[model samples]
Target: MTKSATKIYILDTNILLHEPFAFLNFEEHDVFIPMTVLEELDAIKDRKKDVSRDARIAIRALEDALVDATPEQIAEGVDMSQYTADHGSTGKLAIYPDHLLNQKNLTLPGPENDNRIINAALHLQREKKPREVVLVTKDINMRLKAKGAGMNKVEDYRTDQLISDIKYLSTGYVEIDGSFWDKVTNCESKTEGRDAVHSVERSLFTQPVFINQYIFDSSHSFAGKVVAHDESKVELADIGYERLMGREAWGISPKNIHQAMALDALLDTSIDLVLLTGPAGSGKTLLALAAALEMIVEKGIYEKIIVTRNTPEIAESIGFLPGTEEEKMAPWLGAINDSLDFLHKHDECRDSSMKYIMEKANIQFKSVNFMRGRSIQNSIVILDECQNMTSSQLKTIITRAGEGTKLICCGNLAQIDSNYLSPLTSGLTYIVERFKDFEGSATIHIAGVMRSKLASFAEKNL
Candidate 1:
């Protein structure tokens, strides 16, 4: 394609910080970075957070791309094909070094970095006439502002979006037709312990089902787990109602069908990775913690419990808090304490047994900042509020799991607080979609909120 035919994508600072490799996603297109974005990245590179790490990575990548190249070559653009060859992207990376405000007398309200970025895109649009100039950003308000400023083309960075509409994403359990029970009864069945395992033809289902996914009849009397499947047949293991609803994890029981499925996934030793997504008051954190306690304190399955979360600050940094690492992490771990309190109230031993259970369980509160480079083993690691994490951060955390480690990621996509994340592109959704078919992984979406009547009402109507 000609130069004018290929679109020019101007990336905002937040997009780069969200994903350092974002420039590689635009295939065969010209990627332009405003000077202000580089300045912003430089300014934030010294911080002790994921965004700072991403900024450093982006700066290093750009510097490596421009290494040994003359000023003339830099102005012309650098060939970023090598960096993006794995992604099938042939984009050329360029820096818009010229001062946009000086070149074009635009009526921008202020000299903010966002406006400067917009001015750069507008300048490019005017200079490269007829060539599409699209400003890519994760900021919704910035997109609106760009459009309001007469910039026609603006788009979201969509490399990590597994599902366009999250409302339509699978809930990990499907209600089969009424005839499913008859089909199960007729299929080859054999007793495996107390449960009967069945093999049925794939044609029995009208749609495809993922491995480890639960299939329940409309009457809710029979539930089956998809153990294995091929083009022709599916091996299903019957999940007893007793195993689903009757099983208790440290004094906590499954409150609904969604929670039942979540508990099933959580208690299964074969599944190493479990992802739980839901709205607030859906009991995601509580269920995970209860299961962890049962496994650690009761069953002696795991050596310890490690709880961590993405510390997305709404106002100021938590650095001002005076304490050691564990104490510093205490504020972010209030949910864990709350879950423990609920479990304590329901338990027979009350506060004493609760304290003993906590002590014997060897529970450790960790920040996501210090998780990298360490191989965690023989532990149940719970990553709460994962919707605030980027896909790269999720990958880093998951890859740290050592032998005999079970990683449980819990988050509500609707409650994502990160400015750069959306329900579709958050790390929680990324893992849920990517690991749906993996044998050792399972994802459950809890749709109901059982916290309280008032909380549920607010979640539904407000």
Candidate 2:
């Protein structure tokens, strides 16, 4: 906390791309951006990739930090207090000329950007002596190499990480052993319209339940969500189990209690944001698509359905593959189409049924890349494979929601494909914990797989 004790933290390019405002997170700590990091940002800024926008934003932020500083001052360090709004920042920001370091000081042997960044941290560690010089990056291999090169403090940028362990992530529901009433006998029951409402002492539960999180019995006899709570009492909307299972979306019924809870949330008109995270084949996409059709085609609650997601590395070649954005995105969005086919498989003509449903629902597939600067209104937007995205990328999509629009985000945390993301660090996990207490949001981690025996076996064993 003191000037002498304050650490020197080096920023990596990936850290900035992960969160543009990452520098301000290290309060009172002297921050360093290696000359190599700036060069890397410069190279990345002009690309058509999604990270290009982040690189530009990072550059702007750095420029703002060094606005009035002279070249000498920039090399020495500029006071960071001016850039921070919280007034807690007392450290200085500097661009370390790692390129000027003598060849004998180079610990890592390479011209690669990651190697150069690690060398910068290594030199700083030696100069700072007892003062901690930390290397922060989102890359695991970079951290390992930094530590191997004799850097004392190497860490992943954890400013946006909400939970340290994936197991601790909320499943959006809790199952009570036996009957729920049997455990909580001191319920203050009331009737709100046709629904049963109950208020019980908060101490009765072994775990914390946030707003809109379902609570149920093991027998599947009782189910409800935490509607309201005070310091001592937790209020629940005791929706009957039978009614929950009885709910249907475009002829799709709940196959289990977990699916029932998910359907109950997807069908709720009051909730604007729905987050579905579970294992592969757990009905995340199927349930979301069904709910979208039922709302758009049957209920007419929304005017259209927009499905979008971040495609993987192979999808970067889609420009050469040719066609409209929807056509190019079709390969990555096969899950949505598969769900549609499954929903209509028993119909007189499955392909005809799917075509009619697509037209009737006004369904459109747009890549998440081109969705910027557009305000989507009066529609249901399904964001699939969201676990692979960072929090800022997810924020871009979520902010595009205009009035009368609902966004459904679906993903499997275990199935994350991004090199920089894991279940704990995923945007899906971030938003699930961040929005757990929001009144208009719902998260459901659908348990078990209903896809097929082979898929279920693979999920459990492999």
Best prediction by TM-score: 2
Off by over 4 Å in 1: 100-104, 107-110, 177-179, 182-186, 190-195, 314-319, 346-349
Residue-wise C-alpha lDDT for candidate 2, range 350-420, written one tens digit per residue: 99988988888999999887888999999999999999988888888999999999999999988889877
* TM-score per model over all chains: 0.92, 0.97
- lDDT of candidate 1 over 1-462, digit per residue (tens): 987789999999988888887888888998998889999999999976667888999899788777867877777777777663367677688888846457447646567888889888887889889999999998999899999988979999887787889876767777776746775534788897887888888887776678899888766677879998899788889886556777778777887878988998999999999999888999999999999988887899999999999886541255677887778888889999999888888667788866787789988888887888999999999999999887899999999999999999998888888766778988887888888899999889888889999999999999
Q: For candidate 2, give the lDDT of residue 55.
A: 95
Compute the lDDT of residue 212 as modeled in candidate 2. 95
Q: Estimate the lDDT of model 2.
A: 0.89
- Model 2 scores a TM of 0.97
Best by lDDT: 2
